[model samples]
Target: MLTKDELCIQKEKPNIKDISLELYKEFSEEILFNQIFVYYFTNGTTMRIEFREWRIYHMLAIQHINGKIGKDRFFSAIENGLTLSDFTINDSIKNRYKIYKERITMFLCMYSALKEANVFYLPSGKVQNTKNAKADYIVFSEIGSKGMNIGLMKSGEVFVPMTILISKPSNKMVYLEDAIPMEVERLEIINIPIKEKEQDSEQ
Candidate 1:
């Protein structure tokens, strides 16, 4: 039986229609359970979709248990899992795991659908302020018989770019927000299945 928290998480799960029914059908819970990493491709350009670490979900459950029922009770609940019927501890663990799994599933589905669509780079990480920083790629937009340079800003730590920009001849900069409207593209599902050992290591 699903706990209240698990039910809530399921209710908020991403819609399969948003990505596409065909893509969603490509992946199964058994397949996604074995995946270690997933990449999203727009046109030909690629970016890694950050998967929520299992440690984060585990830590969230720990925090919830500690805050709600205290550390001693948390340990007690763990030791007495067979007999104790504490909903708080069970719900927290179940809820966090549900979120962790759903996010990975959504990304995989979206990537499969968008892999062949028009490429628009989505930069990741912090914005660098150094002149020496080089852009991974430059996109051009035509305006009034002139071509304008749009640079992809990359972070020093991560190779993937996250933001879009518009540069004009007059040195004016236009920053585009990361929110891609739902209507922009229909997404599909793709899976990168890994060995059981590798999946266990990730957890």
Candidate 2:
């Protein structure tokens, strides 16, 4: 069984490779970087923008799929918070994560496309000053990040295990695009939406 929120999220997960191919053909590095900036790097503290972007994007991806927030609301909040610099930078200090984890969901989408298009990353890690990993991307386990079960085949194809969060655990890799649940009964919540604002107004 899966929750209704999870089902909604599963339906929205995109095909990464297909998106990679399309974006690679039609975009520039600056455009991709801007998406990274607004969605992932805007609210970061104690880290340089260039360094924090990748990790934040990964966090956003995990959190987004887990039903913490939607892609539209996340970016829309950012735009509403920061309307200057033509949205190249965010100026709002408050509401960084209101009803949202870290204002993300577009990190890997743009990352896959940029990597496929040969748009490169900074050579050194910004936080530690060491050389970053020599792979296409690296994963970080931060607060609120979820684990994605992935395996690589000898043929160079990647397999991702797809299972409902609330269902009995299964290590089954049933399909290539297995990030979302395609077959699971959904459970709907029966109450007022649980946000701090709603709770506060009830008193």
Candidate 3:
């Protein structure tokens, strides 16, 4: 049984052979997960995506910056407005907006990947099972000794997961997993292709 928020391993298990020990050692260290731009590909199309900046937290920051939301009220909004109520942004976190933004973008990438795979994350973190349902997958970023760890989970098991290492900032597994390629003949930005300019050969 797979919950809508969860996913099973891909059918093409052949594509996911055990990573070499050398490769594993190479990425053993913590990689900075703060890359603002995420590159995604679908149906033979690739695009660069950036996270939307206008979030509730960003709004609170703006309010704080302008003195609209005072310290106590801003903290209240964070505690009440966000789902992860246990952890609120403190002064230490506030000073590191770049790191916070990176973390936010990481989740954005994870959600986008799950959506592309036709999997949905439930607002409530409860796992459920259905009969004869096509199993789906879950992608999540974990904070580890080595910055962020991206995991691919299937059927209560983790088949392919990687520690994001600064040595190799772009992990192909993050993009390639569960993406069914098609005959899409264009460079896509979030699935929309940019119009190209025609050249005059005679010039």
Candidate 4:
């Protein structure tokens, strides 16, 4: 658990891949079984972002059955003082443990991919309509800064600031094209081996 004051202190930026892999290794079981898995990372700045995973596989299972991918998305909250309980969902999925493991694995993979691409380290600005009345750091697409004249932003050009909350609902993972609010037609896809055997074989 990270506090606001602790998050305000500047620290050296840890390798995103290392942090993600470590967190996955340490908390994989908690992520699969718990209602939510919460963690924090600092970008070598006075700001840190909160990452959360929620268990809502029954909804996802229905969406999967109906082929509805719209709700299968991540959420960005710019407000402060938000926590795991703030993002709530009913859980009643069949074979929830299995689905939870699958969804959490996919979610962590997508998260690591985005972090490697620096999607969460974008330009920072204040967001409106946030839960907290006070202004909070919000990360938006490059187009949001440069206007619509520039067309779609290519991969490696997108940005996100620290101090915001990014969350993934339990479901099939969607890439940045669907995750972020940008006119990105495609992003450079990175192949991340999620299984130990696959990693070992790749080595």
Best TM-score goes to which candidate?
A: 1
Q: lDDT, candidate 3, residue 55?
A: 28
Per-residue CA lDDT of model 4 for 154-174, tens digit only, reads 113222211222223332121
Query: C-alpha displacement of 186 in model 4, angstroms?
Result: 19
Cα error, candidate 3, residue 54 (Å): 23
Candidate 3 clashes between residue pairs 3 or more apart in a chain or in different chains? 7-136, 7-137, 8-136, 30-146, 31-165, 31-166
lDDT on C-alpha atoms for all candidate structures: 0.32, 0.25, 0.28, 0.27
RMSD of 3: 17.6
Among these predictions, the greatest lDDT belongs to: 1
- Show the colliding residue pairs in model 4: 121-160, 122-159, 122-160
Query: After superposition, which runs of candidate 3 have C-alpha atoms over 4 Å from their true positions?
Result: 1-91, 118-203
In the range 1-203, model 2's lDDT, one tens digit per residue, is: 22222322332233332232123212222232222211122223111112122233233442333333343344433334522122222333223433222223222232322222211122231212123312222221111233222111111232111111111124212121213222212212222233532464366
Worst 10 residues of 1 by lDDT: 175-184
Mind sharing the TM-score for model 2? 0.19
Q: Is candidate 2 or candidate 4 better by lDDT?
A: 4
Question: What CA root-mean-square deviation does each model show from the true structure?
Answer: 13.8, 19.1, 17.6, 18.0
* Pairs that clash in candidate 2: none
After TM-score superposition, what is the CA distance of residue 118 in candidate 4 from its true location, in Å?
Answer: 6.5
